[model samples]
Target chain A: MADRSASITSQFTGAGLGRSSLIFWALVGGLALLGGLLGDSYVRHIFILVFIWCIVIASWDLILGYAGIFNYAQLVFFAFGAYGSAMLSIYAGLTPLLAIGAAALVGAGIGVLVAVPSLRLKGEYVALFTFAVHLALPPLIQQGRAIGMGGNTGLLGIPWLNLFGFQVSSIDKLTWYWVSLAFGAVCVYLIYFVILRGRMGLAFIAMRDAETFAQAIGVNEYKYKLLAFVVSAVFTAVAGGIYAHYTSVVTPKVLGTEFFLMAMVMLAIGGMGRFPGAIAGVFTVVIGNELLRSFDDYRLLLLGVAVVVTVIFFPEGVAGAFKPKPPEKAE
Target chain B: MSLENVTIQFGPFRALTDLSFQIERGEILGVAGPNGAGKSTLMNVCTGGLHASRGRVLFNGKDVTGFKRHSRCGLGIAQTFQIPTLLSSVTVGENLLAGQMFGSEARGSAPDIPIQDILYLTQLEDTLNLPASQADLLTRKRIMLGAALATGPEIIFMDEPLGGLNAEEIVEFLQVIRHVREELGITIVMVEHKTRALAEIADRILIINFGEFVMLDRPEVVLNDDHVVEIYLGKKHDA
Candidate 1:
């Protein structure tokens, strides 16, 4: 076996064979073109909603899939951005663009607060700690209604994104879709293309696969853990910022564990570690569920059955199912 | 890399008790003991995995007792696990690539170690693109050692490195260990149970009983010593 492997490697001159990612880039371009033509209707709205969830779930995949930090506070961090932007836009009267920056900061700040202690705890401890925070959040806001966090009712009339002097309101829904699509693209490029493709990404994957081995080889556990949380939180906040402006409302329901589970399910369907998997997952689960909503009460049950079938048939998820394997050495 | 009066405890169980040892530079300091004798514990202490409840660990004239495993790795100490822990999901080359990022310097240092060079050294050059899980025992063991070497450690700890190898495989592995120390000028510390393979290659042997030091001597002397024979070597056992 060793001899066979050696012979195979010797046959291949370029150990790191470079392949053109032109097809992938073209796919993205096509999606952009098609999305642009969806034309300001209810279909565009649904597409925009899918893109927002994809942005959030893609960022979540950074920690949950790549860095292997089973963080449960992903949705909570999204809530942080939504609320932060809502407060800034409604009370402080900041532009949506400026408010997005503040919201990302708020998400990162809360990220640090959650990460500081949980990073020290191994595995399930991190999950439980974050889950406790996730469950604790809505009640805290609901109870703090006096402090003007909007409590159980959530904040309403959060400002819409402004283009020049014109507000991109609900009536002009195309602008909202554009905003969501733009933010999702930037976040995906930053998380998947830049960080996950570079040296830091190698470190994260190494750390994820074998923590003790990674540590023995000099990968700092704390540094990578904190990085995964910070980067994931920052981008997830971008999704939240866009969602807040798009819907023109910020609600406590956004804090639901269902969002985190939804992200996980999307990741599961799309494939765990692949970038396209996140996008595919959001489309398959979110849009598919929307389409199935005509079945009313049976919609969730049918979706549950579908996900289970996906798990059984395509264990690697939808993205994993179609991913091409590297060509094997002949015979 | 050395330990002084190091003691490690797990709950009420004292895993390593007041163990003291000095490792000579550029020597194959082999550790031998029975199962549950705390040989791996001592290695863990030096490797920065388990912290000492008392005493100090010093390397390069500085106390690194408070350092974590990653920091200790930056100090040029690398260890291979007894159970062969590896990044099984990645290719052998990718595993070494990850190791190279932290091979000899601190985190964030540009990886300069050539993949082909380390693979050639570990006799794993051909298996570079193969997933680590698919490698044979010999190749997997070599991969483990290669990954550790990629970190550019001055001293290496091998826990039961010779486990599950045939006589010929054992000889080949010992030759590799010898080349690593003699050619690369790295220090070695290996832990094994009554394996003559470890005894034959080690320059000096450190024996322990019940997590306490028993004797430190040349392998020949230790093999013949009554106490070593009674406690660890057993009466008629000779490798």
Candidate 2:
């Protein structure tokens, strides 16, 4: 029986069964099974938050990590989704579902605006432009209309998201958690399989290595860069919409510098540019934040220090530490 | 193909002023000039990397003035950089794959010409899986050539293909370039400072001085021209 079990394990982990592939599928199956069995509210809440953050970080990774655009304005898109949906729902008396669509559109629109100028700039220029957006957006939203956004107070009592008569708020916490998980999984797969596997992926990689060279080779750098930014914004918007409904609150604080810092910390601690790195980063930073809650003021300081140390020493991050070594070639 | 009245201005400096030249199909045109003589600027304009302030780049009887680089690549124009602009992290095969993806008519439909064939052509068969960063300068030059070849271009533009190579490596690369033109029947436009080496390979040499065409004729004539020797070549034969 031991030998049989060993053989089974070997079959799964052996050549042609790429370790990452096996691990990914195993994690998927295990998560599904475990999510079904563990119906606890606390566990469900934690996982839901994880899934929401996973979407944001993963999408963020798509731009910053893969496309090599270090955008610090990611949370602005998230806030746009949350606030856009909230405003549309509150002011227009629109359905929550319609508001979600509005959020996505708003996110995409902002993505285009940001990407158009920012894509041409790289390194510090990209960071500076994105940072300006992050700083400027909330005030613009606040000053625009007191009725729509509620100004400083922010829109309150935003209705729960409902889809085709299936009320998301009425659903069980476990079911909602599973829904979030599924959404996150689909986002990951779409980014990894659809975008990264095709010719677009090659173009993106080319852009990352050398933008001028990519252009010399005939790639339309601006078009593809905008595409990446827009897609990333869409995913981030979806995550924000989900988070808004889950919490029943949409505030300026949602798009605050705190969330931006948290995301940077998470990405840095997890790994920059790796797909699984985003998820791992989200979990580590979020869980670490929660666990260090007792320290209060010192918790943030510790987190900052940890991020710096991780970046300096292990630039590859936690996921880097665990990445499987490539198989040795035959002599 | 021809560049008619092309003028490129970079801020206060005019890189190329009223430069006009024609390169026929199935011809190797060698561009030789001083460091700032605008040889590269001309190539950049031709490849659509730089938009000239004024002029029309006519390729196969079509005005490609506003065409993007990739569109020009699709129209059968390709260029290699002076500095090897390879994706350093990826293998040589992957670099060639990128070239094939962008420039090849295959459009990612059928199986690519095998990696082994590309490697064998550049004598990089053993280095297929090796990252470009791992390769030596000569190997990198060959890989760059291999990548340009993989594009399936009708015309290949090379910038100093023999820059860092030793005598043996230069001979090897010369043979490869000849094979590409002879066996594959591809035209070449080369921006080279190595006049002697280029003269041996190029069918015609176009000499530029101070961003203007000084002389454009047969390699033998241009190289032995008294004016070229006095100004650019610096009285080498006279000395």
Question: Best candidate, lDDT-wise?
Answer: 1
lDDT of 2 at A30: 77
What does the lDDT read for residue A229 in candidate 1? Answer: 90
In model 1, what is the error at residue A168, expressed in angstroms?
Answer: 1.6
Model 1 misplaced regions, further than 4 Å:
A1-22, A323-331, B104-115, B233-239
How good is the docking of model 1, by CAPRI class?
A: acceptable
**Residue A87 deviation, candidate 2, in Å?**
3.5
Clashing pairs in 1: A269-A318, B103-B151, B103-B152, B104-B151
CA lDDT scores, all candidates in order = 0.81, 0.78
Error at B129, model 2, angstroms: 3.2
**Candidates, DockQ:** 0.44, 0.28
Which residue runs of candidate 2 sit more than 4 Å off their true CA positions? A1-25, A36-40, A90-98, A120-123, A163-166, A170-172, A322-331, B104-120, B124-126, B233-239
Per-residue lDDT, model 2, residue B152, is 62
Query: lDDT (0-100) at residue A82 of candidate 2?
Result: 85
- In the predicted model 2, the residue pairs found to clash are A218-B70
